[model samples]
Target: MEVGGSPTWSEPNGPPSPDLTSHAELPEKLRPKNIFEIPVWMGEPDRFCGLVVEWNNEPVHVLPFQKGYMIFGRDPAVSNTFVGHPSVSRQHAAIVWSREDRLAYLIDLESENGTYIDDIQIPLNEPVKLLPGHRISFASCFRRYVFIDQYDRVVKELRKSRPTVRVRHILVKHAESGRPSSWRGETITRTRDEARAQIQSYRRQILEKQEDFGRIASEVSDCTSAKRGGDLGPIFPGQNKAAFEEIAFRLNVGEVSEPVETLSGFHIILREG
Candidate 1:
């Protein structure tokens, strides 16, 4: 249910009248039918990456596996993914990430239609480990999910092969006339360690908050591709430099690289494709 960003909850759907202070005090007629709550993404590293909801062959909804309970249901105000179907409850089910065990469990939120794993109904409120290709369903609502983690093994299962990824980069030169990574009209006139520190900060923000890589690349990237959000297009193995290929083949689709050193400069990579 949680998505990482600027630590702000998304209220995509709000109450009919913004003046209503008390949800309980609001009159029935003025009540908003769909109030969705964007789950607060946890900053914990090494947690499960996310779940791809592919129910009924519908468009996928990515539910990031962040540090807290991921709540799902029809109530947009409370649930991260609000199922528009009639069968879905406002607060139907939740997926909890156990830090100690490094496992994710699907617990029924006392949903009316019940929650299912692989077509079998699970006991209420009990935790169940969702395996790869395991379908997490809410009753007969037709919503389904396939889970994937940050590790390359899990990513291979998700894509059915090692992918040829597209990547974008913001390169900051460290030598003479070194320039800033972004479009701030600044130059990298600092020491190598200082440049790395600055670039690494950008990488940290993207990973911790799930910031949009393309947007950051657009604003700060030093390369000409910054105009296109540093898009390098589809890159196969060995097509890029040794270090770049090392990261490209190993990184997950949405992963960001720490500031990397090359002959030319330090670069921050985003696996766009």
Candidate 2:
């Protein structure tokens, strides 16, 4: 007999099992919000301008924000056109336009080590947006001065013209011993150190395998509930690790992330909704 109208399989006597794979077919709901136009100082306002790594004036690497922030490389010859560096932090810098606040901020992601704002380091993971007159430091073999001009007039104009959007998300985790942890209200961390620390802690837990992240979860989880098998439900944007949140929000729903390490433990995230 045909199964579900397909001739290749036998029909079930009762209702057929729900298709688990259907979850995979669901469309992702999250969307990328429009930020703003790239500032003139970062690139050619006409074209996407930034510090780009080039070989003999031919573009090889494009620094996200290179105009406002300066970089020093070991070789001055190759470094002038393209911010030369051994790593992302040592070679990228920019003055960014913030979509949320409609403000122009400077970020120097290109440095031998990295740069910081208000004492918080930039670009170990993500880029920092600079504020007007904010101090920026650059490190190569030695320290150097970086400048961010006061452009409040432009910022004020942008803020008056652009509209802002409010995005919300939920984070889900398996409960322990049938008791799930209460949802912590949303938090927005302003400092880079605070964000980095949170991401680092989450990574440590995952590396240790203390939380039942499924698969190996049965073997190492401290939570009794997941002993039934770690099955965390739906997770929304901004719910977990900052690093994870940074990337996760970019993904469509029903996509499973490669194992992500967090302070709680390793996680195999499956976005439900």
Q: Write the per-residue lDDT of candidate 2 for residues 1-273, one digit (tens) a residue.
A: 111121111111222233311223545543211122233223222123233332433444333432332333222211221222334231234344433232334444334466655445666323355443344443431222233333455445645664322222222233211112322332232333443454345434554665323444454333343444444443333223344455455545645455443332334443434
Candidate 1 regions with alpha-carbon error over 4 angstroms: 1-45, 58-61, 150-273
Span of 10 residues, lowest total lDDT, candidate 2: 1-10
- Top lDDT: which candidate number? 1
TM-score per candidate, in order?
Answer: 0.41, 0.27
Runs of candidate 2 exceeding 4 Å displacement: 1-72, 81-112, 140-146, 155-273
Task: List model 1 lDDT by residue over 216-248, tens digit each.
Answer: 778766677779887988866434445666766
